[model samples]
Target: MALSLVHFPSEVWNHIFQYLSAADKFSVRASCRYFRKLIDHWSLWKNWTIVLSFKNGPYNSEFWDSLRRRKVSSVVMRNTKTKDWSRLSLALPTLTTVIMDQNSNGNLNFIQDFSHLNRLAIRSSAVLLDLHTQTQLQHLTHLSMCNVLFPNKSNWSFLNLLPFLSSLTSVVCHNTNSFGQRDRMVDTLVSILPKLKHLSLSAKYISPQRDGSIFKPVTSLSSLELIDCLDHSSPEDVGQMISGLKCLRVFFKHSHQGRPEALSASVIYLKTWLSESAQLSNLTVVKGPPVRMYATSIPATITNLTLCVSGLSPRDMAAVAQQVPDLLHLHIDAWPSHLGAHTARIPELFPKLRSLKLRQDHVPEKDFLRLQQLQDLECLEILDRGHWSDLYKKLQTLTRNRLRVVTSSPQRDAFHCPCVSQVY
Candidate 1:
């Protein structure tokens, strides 16, 4: 006597249905009246996001009616063509977020129709903004535009319209080149958007000089990400930026250029900032040498550190152990050939470490097993070029099933670790 799905309680069906896509839910609804009633429940659609693909052709009235009945609040539009958005405004009155991507012939005038919109993201799209409109997105708190383009008109730029979005707390703008004066642009943004807390922008757009006035107005800013922006800036300029921001907890820098001279200079500058900046706890340096060159300068305050370099030596590990004794989380990406005999020392080097992530091409099973010495370690993530099923099995046994091992290919797998909670 096999149990049928219908015999299960509604709660079990609801739990299973939550994982299904909107299309799958529709199919289930058409299969039976009981499923239809379950799908029609308002709670089922509360967190659902409707995806509108204009490239697939215009949706029928029935589609709009379904969304209206479900009270869809979020929508993602792809390959959007020029269409009358007035219909969307009438159908989804509760719409609060809109994400548009790969749209070249669309206009943002439709945004004016949704007064309740609080989040807007435009990526790889060129859309027209009606700057003359008096309506404002008063509720908008987040705005992200990546590789987006607006009309060349002086008044049509997104920068010109940012002042009107007074409620915005986070802004991410990347690869958009309309910003004329980067220094003044940053200063103006901080001065106007007093509530802005997290700002992520390209370093090329900002001046390297430390403007004292800029930091004075941005007390609310806690997280700042400057991408590919450290090529020209001096260490002193970066140090001043860190020291000025009293509330800054996370500072991330990614540099594509790995000049030995720049990296050496960075070592000195980082030492100075690490000693001075009391609030900075999490530090990540990608595509550069590890901070072991000036290991003595690394403050004990830093608990989470990530170094994405070509190689790390045992001598470097010793230096890190002597300095950042309180380190709890560490992520390292190093060449296997250069990390000679260093894995065996990790447990002794970072005894306080709670989580560790290693990205290497090849690691010996014996060396990998040594990590079990870290009694406090809760999770171990490995990104290797080759798989080691045997090693993983041995490691699980050595730890008495207390440790969680997550392994993936470095080239193809997207590395995700539970220990890394913050979105950098």
Candidate 2:
């Protein structure tokens, strides 16, 4: 009868030290000194991310060796004789999200000492970073990078050394091939962030030299996500080469390796890059099907949306889901002839969906029981990847008739996080 560190409480010892594991949350912060001051909360490492790696291989894809045998506890270094990772103690200044080892070239000088950086994900090697002693990231806003190697005797200009970070908006330039030296990295990041709104340009032919006139400083975009992973140009030649966005909302998933690559990448030449991206609202497409789905619609104050219907068509996604009038979120996957004729055509294809996430195994079982006849579905996630217990017992005889489903699959090192106070 003994378990009273002054009768618990410290939020139940920070919920029993956040149920450990992260190598016992770094050995319970090297055990005691009063549980390392209740596990050093900097939001306990604010949405922390620290992925480590090492490589030199002869393997030929099993998805790049199960992604280099992941299980990164904290600091790791293989083939090591530590030649500078700039003093790693997981370089935590309460880091706000980071991922390393796209074959560790390290040195963005530990992300120029994060000081309330919103998010900055990096992979692959360098894209120039030496902003003459960066001053505490000036509240950086979500930036992602993956510019493999481009140092043919560098002069640095990955957005001209963050000219006054200016609370950047959101930029993601994935695997930017040889990212920089192209409009000095997209015209010095649209002339220095300036409340720039979301932008994601994935592998747009990774600079074998492009001068799309630096997307004419995209005029404070609203949203944009373009992934052209070198399927050899043709989303209307990268939409007339970066069609000067004017408050673009979002448009991407763009990775079509031929087979009608969005109909020779021209849905009316992407509606003239969506009519020069003005007041554009939402579009999240992951390619596959979109050769003609958008000819001249989608811009009635550009309502909200998201798409990836494999390779689109079921009568053009039921005629743009019947002209979206503020559509919330719809993510559908499984487009092999939209099985069994689209389950009696879900109310003529999404008549104003609130939230729907039906994926993978390609929406079957009578179109998932006609998705409980959606009268404005608040939230529905029928995500399947095999063995969904006969569709969770037909969603418990259709709609929460108690399948008593509060199950746990637990198999991450077999245990340590199954608590609702660890069950009955």
Candidate 3:
């Protein structure tokens, strides 16, 4: 009953190899000449996502040079040292997108002549590049920096650097610290980047003061995300900020702490504000521990709602049903233990929901299988941690593909569902 690997065609072998990790592929290549030739096929490695780390010893420049010859387009460098950068740039001049995670002591010399680079991301690192380097990166259209700090010695200001990038359209800065001019940076970004349509930033950086000069409305902005930055004490101030964006269609708010009083007040104030805004369509809350916000009524324009909460109760389910009766898509955090015997009963709460996403670390099989009771659910997304494989197999067998099973990464995956018409 042994299967012959040599009997299969190269196409079939290539398809099988696709699922293997890069190290596994290299190991497989060493097995024989045919396998080595198959691995060397340029079509298999042209669009590679290589993860380089200093922990693995110095990166082999010759191997990277081979990848460059094969035209590898995407790379994710993690925990990279300053010395390896020079070799990386020389190795991959054709790269279009680069993600640097925890890169220590970065400099501009590495990326000075990356003419094809369009998207760049930096996370959890304090890297500094001069204004001259920033100005030369005119081809960059999308830039994302999270939990990153800019060094004071660079004498470079993000507020001033952003204005000159004419090709930039989308920017996301999450928990990013700019020396002393956070207010001015936010105010000037819109005017500087005429092509900017989507923006996400930490709310704390935005000036709470309502200075007309500083807080000008960005009419061209279609999407906005404020992460854990809302003033917990001032619901009215947050409401006022939301009121100015008449063209805003997608809004995402991630609250750090869900103090009952602060959250409830903000929810109540936002209900009134959202009701008046006709253009707003999709609303997603990254985290709300209470799972229930006491809004007077949900906005009629809001057809999509996604919430990531610590826990959920029957009362929370009832509250959402009453508030967002017209909602077509509903996603929430669900814990198996929290649901207990109430799993099947909760599906009836969202009478109009066509799509539902349950996010959890683990799921009791019986509780999850009970979702078959949801008659209106056309799509079901299970966003979970490492324990999802068994549940996925069970759900597939039980649902028989009647419910569209959408899959995504466990980290805030519900928000990235493409089957849902509206997303942020």
lDDT of 1 by residue, 1-424 (tens): 2358677888888888886666788899898867877777666787666667755566788878667767778887777655636657777766887877678846777777788888887778876666553255556798777787776653566666777878888777777765764454455576778798767666556564455543333355666555553535433444444443332222224432446656665566556656666666676655444546667766667788776555566776788788778889988766434464478788998998888888534556677788889999988887553477777778889889888877742221111111122322
Count of clashes, each model: 0, 5, 0
Of the candidates shown, which would achieve the greatest TM-score relative to the real structure?
3
Q: What does the lDDT read for residue 350 in candidate 3? A: 69
lDDT tens digits, residues 1-424, model 2?
A: 2456735766786777665545676787676556655666544443333434334433244423322232222232223213323333233344344444344333454555445445655555543445452454556676566545545444554544567677778777655543433333344565666787766665343243344433343455555555543334333333333444433323344434355644543455456566555455565544533534563465554455555445555665666665665666665554443434464475556656656655425556776666656555555554443566766567556756522322232223211111101110
Could you tell me the TM-score of candidate 1? 0.76
Looking at model 3, residue 10 earns an lDDT score of 88
RMSD of 2: 17.5
Give the higher-lDDT candidate: 1 or 3. 1
> Model 2 reaches what TM-score against the true structure?
0.29
lDDT per residue for candidate 3 within 290-316, as digits (tens), equals 545533344556678776554667877
Positional deviation of residue 181's Cα in model 3 after best superposition, in angstroms: 5.9
| lDDT scores of the candidates, listed in order | 0.65, 0.49, 0.62
Q: What TM-score does structure 3 among the candidates reach?
A: 0.76
Give me the overall lDDT of model 2. Answer: 0.49
Model 1: how far residue 229 lies from native, Å: 2.5
